[model samples]
Target: MAVFGTNETKVMLPRNIADGMIKETRTLSTIAKLSAREPQRFGETEYITFNDFPKAEFVEEGAQKASTTGGFGSVKSKPHKAQVTMRFNEEVQWASEDYQLSILSQLGDAGQVALARALDLGAYHRINPLTGSVITGWDNYVTATTKSVEIATADADADLRAAVGLLLNQPTSWGVNGVAIDPKFAWSLSNLQTKNADGSPSGVQRYPNLGFGTDITSILGINAAQGNTVSGTPEAADTKVRAIVGDFQNGIRWGIQRELPVELIRFGDPDGQGDLKRNNQIALRLEVVYGWYVFADRFSKIVDAV
Candidate 1:
């Protein structure tokens, strides 16, 4: 007797996506609005802006072309990373403007979708997936208990010299590598504020362009303060960098945005003056290089001075 009864209830699995209809909506455009505090898309200017209003621009890093005798033997320079500039319209008249438009910023949800999901995304900065210590000098983590020493002035030979000694005293493994500062901080003291070591007061200071969640606790809190003490008074008012000397030396230098090889930090005032409201209408602006992580706005470029 040959019993050949088939098992009708064999367990099966979910079918593949043959229906041609995607169920999930994976994009940033679905959202209506994007704000800074809750960033989703950086509104405006793109390689193709006619499609997306506000328009985004993409600039390339300086390039060096090298000819060689091989298949496509032309060595091209590294294209810079991505960036954007949001011009905060200060005119209170335009109620739709964002007064505190940050020069560099992350994208909002809608913008992210347009560039990522819709467009053919390539060599553009999406988002930093990896999160680590904000300051990346020492190859370790800087705790909240470290002490921060402020130069309180400009970049002086004395301040740099002092920094060397101070960092040497930190607990061995606390990202205690050589110190880093805002390129502006480095320049402010070195060129503009350069003072004679013979008679001039120590006129240089290294501003804090550091990587931290908040506050310079680990640095300022260090009991055996050596090189890393938070220098100049870091304070602000009326939503602007109030102290120019301290601003350049410390405040502006320690912006939330961190960069490499150079960090261009700008300090502005309403009446077109600096900290003490120096008239002449001179808005302090310059490039800070040789530091790290600094990049251009809407341009894929990194300016680093050896």
Candidate 2:
């Protein structure tokens, strides 16, 4: 005899659904791989922590040893709760196996898309926030007064060079040096011209080999990417940050306190008359507990205008 009951189904569903949802979420979210990610243990509480020490310097063999002060440092990120819920009509509970399978697949796909966008937007805001209103001053914003760079002007190459130079000039080594630019600026870059020493047209194209299809993969020997979310409005003249260049892996820290989990509640709908008749719809909740931190301001440089 086969053993199957409500108790067994509930236990199995959460485990299987959580696994499938995590896989789907990763596939749909570019931010997962674009930045650094740290997984938290189950039921762990409090904030995630990161520590870094200074590099050792040479000292005389018999001389007093040099103390690497300020080398020992730490930062923390408090995990925030994020959730999505999908409700299925009571009829789905009794529907055919094929019908049930179809609905579940659709729900999973939609949920993943929603979660991915949320994460991408969160990273965007931190990497490029409003000029004077930066949330935590974590964004490495650049301006004419600060770094002498313009975002929406004809001289885009100069701005890019400035941002890239900042990252390269940092004292630390970078694991992944790349840049994320607004699509509009990227389009502007594609039209850049190479001028002659005499101020005449050199007939040489700056970004002659740049491609805008799907995504801008590379530029000027560095990994280049384009996304409109990097700024609020690419056309706005405000202090909108237009582009960023640096070691994203060492800059952005993403933390997860709990893996995504799917839970179902049959008695969640008290408004429906079916609740009293034991035929109410099922309430599906998808949850993810995560947080993010931008460490080392020098790891990222932003191009903006004031």
Please report the candidate that would top lDDT against the real structure.
2
Write one digit per residue (lDDT tens) for candidate 2, span 173-218.
4544667667667877877778999977686767777754236767
Query: Per-residue lDDT tens digits of candidate 1, residues 41-70?
Result: 222211211222233345467755444322
lDDT of each: 0.22, 0.56
Model 2, 115: alpha-carbon shift in Å? 1.5
TM-score against truth, every candidate: 0.20, 0.68
Clash count per candidate: 56, 0
The residue ranges of model 2 lying beyond 4 angstroms of the native Cα positions read 1-30, 42-70, 126-149, 168-176, 193-205, 232-239, 266-282, 299-306
In model 1, the runs with Cα more than 4 Å from the true position are: 1-145, 153-157, 170-179, 192-306
- What TM-score does model 1 achieve against the real structure? 0.20
Stretch of 10 with least lDDT, candidate 1:
29-38
